[model samples]
Target chain A: MEPYPYTVNPFVHQDRFWYPFVSPFDPCPPIRAKRYVVPPNQFLGFQPPNLLQFPPAQALMKGTLWPALFSPYKKTGKVEIKDP
Target chain B: MWVYEKKLQYPVRVSQCNPTLAKYLIEQYGGADGELAAALRYLNQRYTLPDKVTGLLTDIGTEEFAHLEMIATMVYKLTKDATPEQLKEAGLGDHYADHDRALFYHNAAGNPFTATYIQAKGDPIADLYEDIAAEEKARATYQWLIDISDDPDINDGLKFLREREVVHSQRFREAVELIKEYNEQKNFF
Candidate 1:
């Protein structure tokens, strides 16, 4: 199967927002579009809790003052590349 | 993996000290929908995502830390020189009673920041959708803050932060699409 080319423009048929439909009975129909029903959430029987909730108290420690302290660093086995 | 930039993403020079506004603006600093939550959510989610998307999450999440700093700076500047009487007059006595002039992470209502503000679901699509929603909520909160603020310097910072939320939402939408495409490819193979 050929890979589907993705485009930034949402109007393209291949875009995620667009749904594809095929009509067998009628070759051509005015405004040929089918209503798509979204699948119910199987994981959670009821609707999920609201994403927005009240702010909670501070938990995480403040980030370190130095850049190297906040993030991880791994030494490379190879020598460093230089433009000069 | 991360570098500390001395300057803020946007300049914040609050000329006036309004403890009342500080009380409200603290929400963005440590609120449920604030930058701290956003940064944690994305950084935690990055570990489970595909490589490219992980990079996206890491970069955006790091940027959120900067935003968090910017908010903290605003809160500190606003309450710097406020006296107990001035604070009481501006309806910030309760906050001052608790934190004095120091900036502690908490919402406008004085609720402390908690881990519950964010989630790190193993699924990318679900997580991306959640992120989009989070950005929208932050944007709405910034809009509210901007509406109540009269200081040009502070308003300028809030506007920049609000616009960043919109941009983040768009990027998350694209991330959703990318993840979907990856799943489709995996199934095809």
Candidate 2:
């Protein structure tokens, strides 16, 4: 089953990608790009005054009153980590 | 002087019995990263913090207790009707033998809850940073719980809990900024 059928807009900027310095001599094939999380809160070192907020009902559903602060984590991609 | 609301902060719906899932959910119930640890950690830190920070801690700490109750509700509902054999099969045999359906403060692996799970550094900056980390950890826990959970009804509750962790983390971050500003002003004077 597809855990998340719909996609979130990448423009939302909730997450970021980084290109690791892969060694050509390494045994395993180096992956091109990797996704790393920079949660919404990370951008806001200090919350601004009077940010836009989700409606009360939607707020409860989203788990945050402010839309900017809500980082949706869907169960789709499997986490992959390589041992150094 | 806190008001007791009979209803849950979020509607918890556990559709069917699955003790295996319940066993995994116990990590958030009595685990080091669970709601009880969060509630106690923040509440204990509230006393020595700046007045503004203290109020925020109180608010978040109290909310964590409510979250704990919701976790407890789910655990209880999951295990309420299971037989000893069923529970034993679900890896809760020791829990059943010792506690017998009674909710014990222990992690998924059965390590009992201890005050050591929580920390109160007394300094606002340290405590708020710790609080933010704690909230993020709890959010990750909820995400893993949701990933493992196949029950939609249970997932709904877990989703709510996870989101609360996000909100709390942000609030603590803002509080950290506020406390820093407060300290700067104090130094200027």
For model 1, name the residue pairs that clash: A56-B112, A56-B113, A56-B114, A57-B112, A57-B113, A57-B114, A58-B112, A58-B113
The TM-scores, one per candidate, come to 0.67, 0.84
Identify the leading candidate in terms of lDDT. 2
Error of 2 at B88 (Å): 0.8
Error of 2 at B187 (Å): 7.1
**Which of the CAPRI classes, incorrect, acceptable, medium or high, describes model 1?**
incorrect
Model 2, residue B41: distance off in Å is 0.8
Q: Interface RMSD in Å per candidate, to 1 decimal? A: 15.5, 1.4
Poorest 10 consecutive residues of model 2 chain B by lDDT? B180-189
Residue B114 of model 1 has an lDDT of 98
lDDT of 1 by residue, A9-71 (tens): 221221112224545765676233222211111112222345332233211211222211112
Write candidate 2's Cα lDDT for B1-189 as tens digits.
588898888888888999999999999988999999998898889889998888888898899989999999999999999999999999999998899999999999999999998888877788888999999898888888888888989988888788788778988988887877645365553
How accurate locally is residue B56 in candidate 2, as Cα lDDT from 0 to 100?
A: 88
User: Can you write out model 1's per-residue Cα lDDT over B60-177, one digit (the tens) per residue?
Assistant: 8998998999998998898889889999898778777887888878888988999999988887778888998998788778867876787878877776677577556656777776
How big a share of the true inter-chain contacts is recovered in candidate 2?
0.63
